[model samples]
Target: MKILFNKPYKSGNELKYIADSIESGKISGDGIYTKKCHDFLENKFGYNKALLTTSCTDALEMAAILIDVKPGDEVIMPSYTFVSTANAFVLRGAKLVFADSKKDHPGIDEEAIETLITSKTKAIVPVHYAGVACDMDKIMELAKNYDLFVIEDAAQAIDSYYLGKDGLKKPLGSIGHLAAFSFHETKNIISGEGGMLVVNDEKFLKRAEIIREKGTNRSAFFRGEIDKYGWVDVGSSFLPSDIIAAYLYAQLESLEFIQDRRKSIWNRYDNAFRGVLDSKHDITLPFIPSHATNNAHMYYLVCSSIDERKKLLAYLKSNGILAVFHYLSLHESKFFNGKHEGLNLKESDRYTNCLVRLPLFVELGEQEQDFIIKHINEFYKKK
Candidate 1:
């Protein structure tokens, strides 16, 4: 069998949508499809405003702008997250205060955040790793006590929901003052290369529009069909091309079915690996919290150490399964290494050294899953 992400889910009528956008002769940003995406997110997530961006990276950058992050300011986020989560603030001249991940999951430990917050701390960026919702309640409580702004890095949480204390499931991006999402090709859904910014606060909504449109009220001008628009604020061209928006709209329309199928594949892996996972102290299953819903973005196993993980990686490769690993713990990377391990980030490094992600694309088949599991079982049994 050929190596693939092993999950199977087509995003949308990508080519057709793009072609339609081209035929419409308005392939610029903020066209029909862009409005559709805005409406889709606003209605689905109860967002006060939704802006399509070139990428989640851009959405995050916009958040940095809206918060007016200044030089020497510090932004707190987990060590085990995609760089974009912190890079946005870093670009705005803010220092990244890398917090450790929770012992149970990749999400940042809320307890650790308080100790990191200081007079120089301007904002907190919480990443919801692997489409699993972070402890937003705890994070929010901390933010409230500190009087800080919460910008959720919801890059993997497009359709995922956070289970609130009231027993209701809230949209992932809707909880934070501002949140970002990805539409990369590898994600559950895609617009080729597009993303979104969902802002809950009306105060920043107007400024966000201008920043997304190169510091102009172009969005308003476009709506007014104005004869001219001038520089209105400090912004950039973060909006995605109209064709990109069209493709994303197609994916959004099929989100329900796409999410359902992805969940099934995730379940398959979870069920198949349960025995091998719990059968030993060395191999561990992904630890998801009770209140969080798995979006099936990935299925990863935790080994005992970095050496064991590397050996397993070699074994999986030799067996023709493209099982992979992730997140080098930005805390320890050559470019980002630091001396102060204040919170005893033993758990963060523990996560980096141990976690092994399995192949989990939407189009992955059952037979392939069985083959992958078979190799995994053999690796464990013989060891």
Candidate 2:
């Protein structure tokens, strides 16, 4: 049997909700199901406001606009993150100042961010890689000291929490001034290709809705808050269809079950590989900090070198397991390499060459998991 890297899980209510949405004759954006989704996320996470968008990229774009990113403004983020993290700001003509990832984890090094700030610096984006929370307290303090906007690229961090120095646990997206989440098929929850813009700072609350409605106050108009709506700000069509929200709401109803199953799979992989491989193998397992909770987005191993990762990926593929490597250091990419300043982001490049993600999905059976575990061990034994 071929073990795929990811298989989107269904909670059996997606079609039912879709049919209900169709029967309601409001299949456009922000219908009954859409409101349900917004309410669900807002109530569960205590977000100031939550608006569904077509994709996480659109959400990030909305954030860039909310923070008033402009030409010559510099936005600081990790070089190891997905392109959407940088593209959102780049689209607004802002200069991207890429930071390095932590030596222990793929999240951005909060300590390194302060030195990257400049007179034109506008925002600090913290990406919570693999549903693992970054050190929000330090990041937030830096943003406070520098007076920079904090936009969380929380694309993989749903249901994750960060434990603050105050001895309180706060949800990941809630800490940032603004945050974006993805419901792509690979995430814990999915809407095929959907995302949400979470407004944490009430200052951007009204504008966030206006920006989402194609630079108009249509959301307020629909709610009878305004008699007429017109173009008021620079924005785009970022809203997702109600049909997508219908599917996402179904998944939201099963969020607990999904998180539980995914975490179980993640723990199994960690337990099987932790301290079992030889020191010569030079494989580093996933490490969750003491202050973060695991939401089980994906499990990855950091091999000693790019060559080892390539061989392991080939071995997994030859054995019919579709394991894969992740992002390729955006700083070194052809598109942005010329634009990036001459900063040696060693840790970011290390993750780019070495990180390999294994198959971790809710539908993965115990037998299939064991087969994957056995093959990985056997391959390393021969190494």
lDDT of each: 0.85, 0.93
Instruction: Give the Cα error of residue 331 in candidate 1, in Å.
Output: 1.5
Off by over 4 Å in 2: 278-280
Best by TM-score: 2
lDDT of 1: 0.85
Q: How well is each residue in 157-212 modelled by candidate 1, as lDDT tens digits?
A: 88888998878899899998999999998788887678899989889988998999
TM-score of each: 0.96, 0.99
* Clashing residue pairs for model 1: 6-364, 7-361, 7-362, 7-363, 7-364, 8-362, 8-363, 8-364, 9-362, 9-363
lDDT at 88, model 1: 92
Q: What are the RMSDs of all candidates, in order?
A: 1.7, 0.9
* Candidate 2 TM-score over all chains jointly: 0.99
Compared with the true structure, the alpha-carbon lDDT of candidate 2 equals 0.93
